[model samples]
Target chain A: MAELTYREALNRALDEEMARDPKVFLMGEEVGEYDGAYKVSKGLLGKYGARRVRDTPISELGFTGLGVGAALAGLRPVVEWMTHNFALLALDQVVNNAAKMRQMSGGQLKVPIVFRGPNGPAEFLAAQHSQALASYWAHVPGLKVVAPATPADAYGLLKSAIRDDNPVVVLESEMMYAWKGEVPEEEFLVPLGKARLAREGRDLSLVTFSKPIKAVMEAAELLRAKGIEADVVDLRSIRPLDEESLYASVRKTGRCVVVDESWPVASVGSHVAWLVSHNCFDLLDAPVELVSGEDVPMPYNHSLELAAQPSADKILGAARRVLYREDI
Target chain B: MAKTAKNGRNTLPPREILFPLLETMQLIRAFEEKSGQMYGLRKIGGFCHLYTGQEAVATGAISVLDLSRDYVLTAYRDHGHALACGMEPAPLMAELFGKLTGSSRGKGGSMHFFSAEKHLLGGNGIVGAQIPIATGVALAQAYEDSGGATLCFFGDGAFHQGALHESFNLAKIWNLPIVYIVENNQWGMGTSWKKVSAQSDFVATAAAYSMKGLVCDGMDVLNVRDVVGEAVEEARKGNPVFVEARTYRYKGHSMSDPQKYRSRDEVDEYRRRDPIVFLRSRMEEAGLIGEEDWEAIVQRTEGLVEEAVRFAETSPEPSLGELYADILA
Candidate 1:
């Protein structure tokens, strides 16, 4: 096993996939000359050359639709959106074309493409740039959404997403890019639709993924220090969600808290909370608490920005409230 | 005035190709006219946009393709293009009927017809959505160093879309092999193209991408054939182009439209230059056509459309289980 950052893990996956398939290419703004806006595609342009590692104009809708079209013509394209906030410009292509082509074409076209970029709030990006928009995409059928919390998951899930026949959206985070974790050297795949148990406890379940998984883990530690054990489940796949794992954890713990970086209303984590309350109604000892970003747009003020978003402190409070302990 | 193209790549059609070209235009018109009638009878549902007066654009443009290898991508007014590309009318009819035997297994009707073997990509419904995709398809051909090129067809109104400009830029820098054909039929549903666009000169839009831009008489099949042929030959050399075919649609945009946008006189003026009529006259002037040939072509087209209707009527509705199928690989 080799220790790597989430960014390096993703870069390795792109490198490995491109090396394996001649038809696979990467295209996006700054992905080539700039080595990716976030440097996740570092060294790829040098290794793959301009033909395979293409830098695009700041035309997201154009390039994204181009990626979908290339997929129809039998090329596997991994498109970088620079950031998910910028991806809204290509929403018509993503939702209308990439997501609909296969079924709409009656099984004639399979768009084996991956749209990856940093998502969720980082620092004080404010308003448009700080939104966690996974739920909007996850709500759509014919698309797979994955958010990895660890370097290993990033490597595995991204490689799998490139190989997937359907369009897959990999939501990454700028904050989590620098976090390091151990990744296996040998070929490995963290299959889509599976959840990883980050930490195990018995009193309560901490359900989350991506950046919020870190908060949930810290909150679990705080709970453990207080002698209130909590189990942490990182939902690797948002669509084709690991329902069995979520049900089993909630059934065993009898208490749950879903932490999402997005706002509370109709958030991806809120879906998990609803699933637990309905499916494990008899198994519950307390109401399932959802720890999510505040409803308001992220503020520019650093402290208020931090307050607007979910934090380890907030997850800890939700865990405590679910466990019938001190709320603050 | 550079009818030969800025790259000097245009080719004049041989007399032998005219008969087949006319047949293609006739087939497209016959198919569309029948579809319009079927739509009026309430047998066909959903939005049905006819390519009535633009027969020459589809027929003339597709003639330049090596259909076995080259690709065709167009917007929703696609029945004409589908027929010209040689897709069986039965499956296309079945698609409109939403039956199991449809081209898209009834999933895509009127708006989305594709044939992998024929290399017809799809009839995209979203305005100007196919522009970027077609550009990407051209990119794939270029990356593989394949001689294959793509023909991207869109309406004049779609020319105003941002994606089209984006495609032009990508096509230029990448040297992607593509021919962008804009069917300037002059109306975007209820609104005129002039009202919708500040600059109605579509072929001029290509200069921004440094691509070869040309305009052809879209109402004349032979004229469309010669110009698009030139564009196709140039694109095969890894050079993309922009072509504006001055065409018009005789039918309303779709079945639901009242077409209160234009006058009957405007429709009649364009009809006088109907591509099929123009080609037939040219063929007569050249003494290459006979009454028997026209009768045979008519018989063949009517019979095929009739059989297609029968096939669609007999084809079963999709099974209840089919809704869950084709969602994944």
Candidate 2:
């Protein structure tokens, strides 16, 4: 095992997959000779040559549809949208073609394509370039959405996504790419739709993923100091949600709190809360609490933007409310 | 004047190529006329776009390619393309009737016909959407060194879309083996070319992308075959080409269209230069077929169209469970 940053882990995954399958190639605005806008595809062009590590023109819809067509023709393509915000230009291809091709073609075609890039709110990036589109993509039935919070999980889940027979959306966090952890050097794949428990406790379960997982974990540590043992579960895959893992955790803890970086309305937090309530209503001692970003569009002011997103303090507050419910 | 064939062989014998084109055009004409009657009777619903005036485009394009290796992807006006690509008329009619025996298993009614065996990728409904998809298909062919080419067909209106330009740039940059044929039928639904396009010349647009451009008289099957043949050959040599086929539609855009945008006189004028009639006259002048032989071909096509109708009428509709059959592999 070796320590690898989240960005390095993604690069390793791409390197390994491209080595194993020639059909697995990378294409994005600056993925090739530019060494990737985020450096996630760094040095890949040197190793795989220009054809496999392609740098596409600034046409998201065209390249995305090209990826879909290549996948249909039996190639596994990793299409990088610089950010999830840019994915809007390619939404027609992602939602209409990539996600629905299998169903539309009556199972005759499988789009083994990955649309991976940084997503969610970033400091001072303003409204256009910052959005958590996991909920939007998760609304579609055919796509598998994943957001890995750790270096190891990032490498493992990306490998799994590349190998998946269906289209997968790997939503990376701009703020977490530098986070480092122990990652295995050998090949490993974390199966999609499985939840990973980062910490175990008996008092309350703090369920979160992507960038918010770090906030929830910090809050869980704070709760431990107050003699409240809080369990932290990271939902690595959003589409084929690991309901069984969630239900088992909620059944043990008897109370749960969801922290999501997306807005409060119609968010992934809402869905998680609904699932916990629907499945473990009898086991729960208190109602499920949701801590999500505020409803307003992400502002440009640093402090205001910080306030708009769910913070560790907010997760701690929600955890306290869920654990100390008087109605229970 | 001497015509130069790329392979240095004499041009294909007149009857050898001409009869197939004539037969395919006759089949398409008969099939569309019968389909129009069926649609009028409410047997087939949804958007039905007939290719009555553009038969030569499909017939000529398909004739010039090797069906076993080449792939064809087109827009909504795709029945003639499908028929010309060797999809049995019966199954195609069944598809339009939303029956199980149809090519797409009845899921994609008119606009989204698909047959993998024939390499007929799709009859995509979205305007200008298939351009990139077809370009991608060509990219894949080049990547795998499959030595195959993809023929992407779209209307002149499709050139107005951003995707077409984007696709053109990518195909040119990569030297993808593709031939983009713009069937300029003068009208996109109801809007004429002059009303929408600021620069009415489609060839100049292709020139912007650095790809070879050609403007051909789409009414003449021989001319279409010659021009498209050159482009397809260039595509096989790993250079993408763009062609603007200047043709017209005798019928309305779709079955429900009232023809309010253009007058009856315009429609009558296009019919006067009908590709089928032009081909028939050329064949008759060359003594390619006697009057009885021509009548026999027409009778055979009528019987085939009636057989297709019978097949569609008797075919069973897909079951409720089948709705879930084709969504995933």
Candidate 3:
């Protein structure tokens, strides 16, 4: 095993996939000459040449739809959105064409494509750029949404997404790109629709994924110091959610708290909380709690921006309430 | 004006060339007319857009394709294009009927018809949505050096969409092998193109991207073939082109349209230049097909459409379990 950054892990996956399949090509704004807007595709243009790693004009809808078309014609295209914020411009193609093509064509056309990019808030980019938009893709049927917390998960999930026959949306975190983690030296795959047991405990369940996993883990540590143990469930994939794992953890702990950086309404976190409360209603010691980003546009001020996100403190508070230790 | 067979790529004898073209157009006409009647009887449902008057655009342009390789895409008014691409009418009719034996297994109705074997990508329901996808298909063709071209069709109603301009720019800059054909039937549902667009000259939009542009008399099938053939040949050589086929739709936009936008006199004027009538007159002037041959062609098309209706009527509805299938591969 070797330690690699999340960005490096993603780049390796792209490189490995492109080398494995000649039909696999990468296209997006600044992915080639600029080495990716976030540098995840560094040196790919040089290795794969211009044909495979193409730099597109700033036409998201056009290029995204083009990727769908190429997939229809039997070419695997990994289209990178410079950022998930910019993906809104291409939502029509993503939702209408890529998501519906296979079923709409009565299973005649298979669109084996991946749409990957950084998602959620980073620094003080303000409201438009600092939104966690996974729920938008996850809400739609016929699309698979994966959010990886570690470098290993990023590498494996991305490779799996590229090989999958349907359209998969890989939601990466801007803040977690530089975080380093151990990845297997040999090839591996972290299959979709599975969750990893990040930490184990019997007292309570802390379910989360993506950048918020770090805060959840920290919150678990603080709870451990207070003599309160928590099971940290990192949900790797969002759409085909690991319901069995969530149920098992919630059933064992009899208490659950879901942490997500996205807004609370109709969100992944809210959905998880609802699922646990509904399925584990008799087993629960208390009502399921949810720790989410403030239900408003992210502010530009640094302190307010940090306050708007789900931090370890906020997660701990939610844990306390769910565990009936709010007074302590 | 359409070039003569001697001057164009069509080296077939006049009778062989002219007869098949007329037959294809007649088949499309018969199929659409029957579909309109079925729609009125409520046999077919959900936004049935007829290609009654604009038959020549799809028939003529798609005629230039090597159906075994070249790809075709269009907006929802796709029955005509499906027939032109050699898809059997039965599955198309079944699709309209939403039956298990339909082209899309009843998942995609009047708005969506797809045949991978025939290289028909699909008939997209959204306005101008197929433009970028068709451009991408052309990109794939260029990347593989396959020497195949893609023909993407959309109505004048879709002319102003940002997706269309974006696709045009990408096709030009990348030198992708594609022909973006705007079937300028003039009305975008109830609103006229004159009200919706500031510039009515669609061919001129191509020059903005410094790409080659061509315009053809969409009312003339032979003329559509000549222009589209020239454009496809250019596209295969790495020069994408934009074509505006000037035509009109005799029917309302869809099954439910009242068509309060235009007058009956306007529809009559375009009807006088009907593509089928124009071709038949030219055929008579050349003595290629006599009156009896025309009658035979009409009978053959009507028979084909009747058989298609029978197939669709007999086909079963999709099973309840099918709803959960094909969401993902």
Candidate 4:
């Protein structure tokens, strides 16, 4: 096994995929000479040259369109949005073209494209930049959405995404780029639509993904200190969600708390709560609790931003609520 | 009767080619006329856009394509483009009927006919949405350097979208093998092109992208064939060309359009210079097609349209299972 950061794992995945397939290519702003806005594509320009690793002129819709077009024309493209925030500019191309091309064309075409960039609330980059937009993407039928919280998963899931035949969205976190983890030394692929069991326990089930999973794990540790053993489910892939695993966990635990980075209404956590409530209706001992970000727009102030997002305290409170610990 | 084209472009294809070209235009006209009638009869549902007056636009452009290698993608007024690209009429009509035998297996209705073997991409519904995609297809063409070119057709109303400009800029910089043809049919739904476009002539604006641009009479079939054929050749040499085909739509934008935007006089003015009539007369005056030949072609197109209507009527609707099938694979 080799240790690496989330950014390195992503770079390794792209480099390996580009080397493996001639039909695969990279396109986005600064993916070449500028070495990516976050340096995730650090040396790809020199390694592959401009022919494969291209630098685009800040044209999200244009390049994203080009990516979808190339995919339709039988080329695999990895379209890097500088961030999910900037991706909104190309939302039409993604939502309308990439998502609908396969079904609308009656399966005559396959959009083997990836729209990858940093996502979710990060630090004090309030308002536009701090929004978590994965649920909106998950709402679409033709897309496969995944977010990896560790270096190993970042490598494995991205490698699978580059090879996937459908349009895939990889919602990486800006906050987790420097976070390091052990990845297999050799090639491996974490298949899409599988959820990993981060921690195994018996008292209650903690459900979450991406950046918020960290706080949920900390909350699990706090619960463990109080002699409350809790199982944690990391939903690596948001869409094609591993309902089988979630149902199995909720069935065993009988109580669940979902921690989400996005707001409450129609959020990813709400859907998970809904599914658990509906499918595991007979198995439930208490109503599933959801700890989601504040509904208001992300605040610019540090303290307010801290309060606006889901944290360990919030997750701990929700877990305690589900665990029937009325008195903290 | 004029032997030379209205554009004065000496593009009189041989009798063999011109005969089929005239026949194809007749086919488009008949098919569209039937589609309009069916829309009225409620045989086809959803937003049904008719390609009534722009027959020559697709006929001319597609006539020059190397069908085995070339690619053509267009906007929602797609029945003409699909037929012109050599799609089977039965499947196209069935698609309009939302039948299982349709080109897109009945999933994509009138606005989204697609045929992979014909190299015809789906007729995109979103305005200017296909521009960037065409540019990307050109990028693939360039990467392969395979001498294949892409023809991206959109309407004048689509020119206002930001993606079109971005596509032009990218195509220019990449030197991608693509040809952008704007079918300037005057109206984008209810709004006229002049009401929205900054430049009086869109072709002249190609200078901003440092690309070659030309304007031609869209009503003239031979002219579109000659110009687009030459542009396709230039594109094979890695040059992207911008073309504006000044055409007209005889019908309203969609079946539901009241068409209060324009007058009957304007429609009649354009109809008097109808492209199909123009092509038939030119072929006859040049001794390329006899009166008997014109009658036979029209009768054949009518027969084809009748067969298509029968096929659409007989084909079965998709089973409850098919609605969920194409969403993944």
Candidate-wise lDDT, in order: 0.89, 0.88, 0.92, 0.90
Docking class of 3: high
Model 1: residues with Cα > 4 Å off, grouped in runs: B1-16
Q: After superposition, how far is residue A282 of candidate 1 from its true place, in Å?
A: 2.0
Model 2: residue B28 alpha-carbon error in angstroms: 1.7
lDDT by residue (A163-225, candidate 2, tens digit) is 998899999989989999999877889999999999999999999989998888788777777
Across residues A1-328, which tens digit of lDDT does each residue of candidate 4 receive? 8999999999999999999998989999988988998889999989998999999999998999999999988999999998998999999998999999889888888899999999988887989999988888989999999999899999999999999999999999899999999999999999999999999999899999999988988888888888888899999999889999999999899999988889899999999999999999999999999999999999899999999988989988887678778665
TM-score of each: 0.97, 0.95, 0.98, 0.98
TM-score of 3: 0.98
Query: Could you give candidate 1's per-residue lDDT for residues B13-85 as a string of tens digits?
Result: 5567987888888888888888988888887898999999999998989988998669999999999999999
Tens digits of lDDT, candidate 3, A26-126: 99999999999899999999999999999999999999999999998989999999899999999999999999998999999889999999999999799
Clashing pairs in 2: A102-B327, A103-B327, A106-B326, A107-B326
For model 3, the DockQ equals 0.90
Per-chain TM-score (chain B), model 1: 0.95
Task: Give each prediction's DockQ, rounded to 2 decimals.
Answer: 0.83, 0.60, 0.90, 0.84
lDDT of 2 at B78: 94
Give the residue spans of candidate 3 off by over 4 A.
Answer: B1-13
Summing lDDT over every window of 10 consecutive residues in candidate 1 chain B, give the lowest-scoring window: B1-10
Model 4 clashing residue pairs (backbone): none
Q: Which stretches of model 2 miss by more than 4 angstroms?
A: A325-328, B1-13
Docking class of 4: high
Tens-digit lDDT track for model 1 on A1-328? 9999999999999999999999889999999988888899999999989999999999999999999989988999999998999999999999988989888889888889999999999996879888899998998889999999899999999999999988999999999999999999998988999999999889999999889887788778877888878888999999889999999899889999998989888889888899999999999999999988999988889999989877888887777678787743
